[model samples]
Target: MEHNLLQAFTTRKHTVLTSSKIDPTGATSTGSLKVKDNISTQGSQEKLGKSGEEEKNLKSNKKLEMRAKDTGSFNIKMNPLNKDSLDKPDENGREEKSTESSKKMQTKKSETGEGHDNSSFEAHQETQGAKGHHGNQTTTAKIQQTTAFISKQDNKRQANQTQIGRSGSNVMLDVRRRDCSKTKCQYVIWQCHHQCMGWGDRLRGIISVYAFAILTGREYRISHTFPCNLKEFFHGNKTLWDEKVITAEHATKRNIKLFGFLPTFGSWVLQSSNLSETFPEDIITFRTNNDIIPYLRFNKNFTKTIEKAFSMPIDDFHYVTLFRRLFHELFSPNKQFEEKFQKYYQLLKPSNDSTLVCAQIRLQFIKVSGMKNVFKFLQETIKRVGKSKLLVSTDAENVRSAAKTLFPEQLVDIEGPLGHVDKPGSGCRDMEKALTDFLMLSKCDILIHSPSGFGQQAAMLKYPYKDVYQINYAGVITNLTIPIFKLENLYEELGPLGGEQPPSLPSRYIKNPQKYFT
Candidate 1:
């Protein structure tokens, strides 16, 4: 009986070991059979004491085999069936492998100079997470790096689009056309009816009318037929302003009320209750040589309107900012004028490191020629600025000849007969030269000019107002503190013109502004 019980216990122990090795789900049943076999074997050993030692040794061997099989089964159940899992080592080895894989991917990405797609990267991250904790961390870092690269690329594309838009590319032109098509646009036509004014004067009137048009929400147009069509030299920057939009019926007296001078007109508009109500005409034409910016600055209503239209604060509203915006928006050189400007500008060879000084000598408007003093100032300025180029723009041929002869090394000017745009018999070629000089003068580092509106307007084009000196009638050089757009400065310099005094709000209007507006 003892022999039979021992043999049966051995057979049951072998079965439990085989089942546990083959299937992890048999662990519970294998454990129960082991317990039962141990009880039976111990009983058989005690009943047959002669083979007790052998039985004890066999039981010990069985416990070792069962433990080994159980551990193997648990491992097979816990681990996933994947190549990475099958080859994985201990915790330290997995961490090292994760680090190595991350470095390899980064190096490959850098070598190829390419970014991973977002969807593919996300899938990689999920696979890495399933592999190990260290791999998940590495994937997180890669995601941040790739995301930043994508963001940078997006920003670059946006910047390029913005630059294209500002250059008046076809995209922006189409957008403007769409906007105009959506509404019945109103216009303020600035007509030059044989006005005895120079280019500077006409520009001032045009910009003034443009400002009014902005306040009244109307498009600004130009009709200058005295010397030549304005389009012969200049065209619009973002828009076209010519007679094509106007017809014979639209040019009647009713739509052509003229505002003779800017100061008086500005005063009348400011004091009036409402501009639209007072001037009911659809197309009000202005023909003046003076700017209404200084007058507009004083009117609270006008300032508010301007600020809103430009999306700027009133404090930021100044001569330089305002004039630059208007000039660039309204005027662009035509093909002929642009070619001439480029030729002269190239002759100057303006450099970023080296300074280029512009001297505008207008003998037509100023009473005294301060030629000697002007030369002296130029010499001092050149010496101060070290390596420099000097560009001279003037209406007189003798002045140009003198400058070229005196400063041959530094002097640069267009070779042509100078002529005023407003004067009759000034051919289109000469007028184009004048326009080219005006634009080139604005592109200088320093400016030395005479007390002429042409010089003043040219100087206004330079942003942040560079070192500018004005030579008076007595040939005395003075540094202009404020731009010519300032009311006090303009009034002091130009004095009362067009038989109109400096703009002043009426006392009644000043006391009760609401009463006048209402």
Candidate 2:
């Protein structure tokens, strides 16, 4: 569509340019003609409240830039609708096309005249349909600059322009003169490229990236296609989600790294090597829950090492405490999720000891590992911790049914695997149950879980007095006390009130340590 911005130019006003919009949260936003309630598409100066939903439909709008120069001549730069104006005839055609575009710009400038005559521009202003000018337009132009898109898409469908990956980069064209030449500004983007498979796994992936950003002092941006439907919850402009929605196209171009499984030591080694001074890459992405524990340790040595490496003051950074803070920043409970959690979390009364236990039996993976002992483990938990309400969260359908059968009245779940709305799991698992399960599990006084990041996360999020148990493949139930189960002590349980020790990786997957490396 065409805009009368140039026509409005002579009116002596800065028009509202919607060609680009910067997200307030520092995330990149698409320049689309989206209906934002009653907000006008025209460049109206009226500001609107942030309470309504808007449709994001991009427009091929033209941007007109008029810059007042010190020489008393105005430099005008207009972005044309034809993006292919800069396309090369071949891969080798790039230089030629660039030269041609430059020549055309020079030709336009020459046509405008080599002399810095403001009266000549004024004489031609009305000829170009710029009316209502009082006198000679007081402006000067020493240099002219224009940026055009060279699209690779077919010409019929209205191909989009190449996006500059800066946060809130939606402006179509930039205007400047020779003296106004600026430095190339670079923006840092950290994305979690893990497939939106499971909710807990997705959380682990993003939380890892967030930790990375925090360590490097960068803004972490969120996307739309993430596992959970968190739009309404974060729409209130709280936390780091206060900006605009990110499109799939823009996110694809900004993905810099993809992290898979890397054991704790391997991760540490990579960090020391790749990030000794600073992150060399422009963007960093990772797989779901890669080996990050080593980088996020709570020990004095680890703290000093990280601080020395990043040259930042983080002498007091604790692994669990930092995790807690990041979790709070990323995932505030939505009203819907919170309502469901509170309903079942407070269902059963606590015992005289006020001890409530929720066991997250990862039946699918453990059974896949050839451990066919879900029922036996539940029975053992009941036997050892009597009268404690059993809130089970498992993936297998059969496991949920069996728990209901075994504990009948005593067993309660957050409506079980199928009851969740998000449905974060795959194969024999229920995905939606992840949020409900995690929320309810966090409320329990004790957690008996399989040795996975999901349980590890919940356990770390639990309060100080709360306890956690890691049920290994061998059915050895080990309680995780204050400092948590280190990589060396995963097979062994710590004593009730031991001395203060620093944090380390749990022994569950870090056996060979390098075995889990990608």
Candidate 3:
């Protein structure tokens, strides 16, 4: 009375499908099954009208048979006793139908000399045609998709592992791959609109600029004007170097310096001039520092201003937490420095808990009287801490030789980075040496340094910084304000490192790259 169509297709299990029809009165059947979208579902059914004529032809035998046959049209039938059948027959009729169906099936098998072998073969080529089924994707596709996903996850895990490898060294060089792949707004350029000062003063000014960037809620990158290209030393990307850094800015700083000492007086303000043409809308108001804020003062009002700018509570007053996080995620010594540092560290690392003193005396700061004071302090310090080892890192070779002569029994020193010039070729070599020396001092149990920028930077790099010994002009060595590590250190990382990483994109600079990368 009606037509039904079945298809062969793939599913989660990728099973093959087949359909069967019975000729109740020897009717014709003709159709083919297909997979995927290859076949249509409209089928033919012409039955029952010729049943009387067919029955009359077989009445002489007084028997009925159920078998599959092919004619111009399909004629499918089912007995009441069959579970799939629509009719429900009485108990007697059901028994009779079962007996007749079984006898007919046996007769067909005997005629063929074998039973149907359902498990003898896999699904034919007909079934393999379809790529997918309703609500189920093909197994092959699913496997390929899963494999791609796992590969990405594995890459990230390996990156994090590489980051952990740096823990053996003194510098906290955790290299978490920051996912800055998202589209980013233009980043503000942070540089001291000046270049006439020494590398030390320039570095401090750069730090101040960075702090401003952090407070303003805009992405920031440095514009290194010194001879040593910071981007090259740190292995940063060329795209991030701010090629458009205003040269006029530097000229202005130099011009003002010629006239007086007050050029640096009110320079720490967010002005239209300081705002890079690339990112002008980042700060709403242009204002100067209320009082030229010192480097170490995370003073109450300044602290509040930063907290409000970021709209969060800053629990650590020293801001060491913030500064270290920034340093770890931004600056890293290159391969040469790393290998050199490891070599020196192994050579100097103490065998036991015996107090190892690392003295970072700047040649510029050490005078005749101060030199005597330093000698006295070293002797007194050695006597006070038994089995103590001494390591001195200084800018001048004379200081290195003097320390060695004074304490012939202890390890003396390595000459600090060859006079501090800031160019890439020879200057970079000097930078590398300084980096190694910084690592040497950081690894020692007791750190001693003077007010020199190079020495100060080394002291600040070490955690529990509060224990660092700062030597005054009087040659007195004592720990200044003890700097402690912040909770942020546990998760912050030095974005992606090395040249081979996927270049950072502004879009992927997620609000918190660590949460996802970790």
Pick the lDDT winner.
1
Give the winner by TM-score: 2 or 3: 2
- Angstrom error of the Cα, residue 434, model 2: value is 0.8
Model 3's alpha-carbon lDDT is 0.35
Tens digits of per-residue lDDT, candidate 1, 402-434, equal 566556678876766675665566656655676
lDDT of each: 0.45, 0.36, 0.35
Alpha-carbon shift of residue 207 in model 2 (angstroms): 1.8
Could you tally the backbone clashes for each prediction?
Answer: 0, 23, 18
- lDDT tens digits, residue span 87-140, model 3: 222344312233223222211112221222111111111110111111212211
Candidate 2 colliding pairs, count: 23
- Measured on C-alpha atoms, candidate 2 has an lDDT of 0.36
Best by TM-score: 1
Per-candidate TM vs. native? 0.56, 0.47, 0.46
Off by over 4 Å in 2: 1-197, 224-228, 232-238, 245-254, 261-288, 292-321, 349-354, 364-387, 416-431, 482-518
**Cα distance off (Å), candidate 3, residue 177:** 12
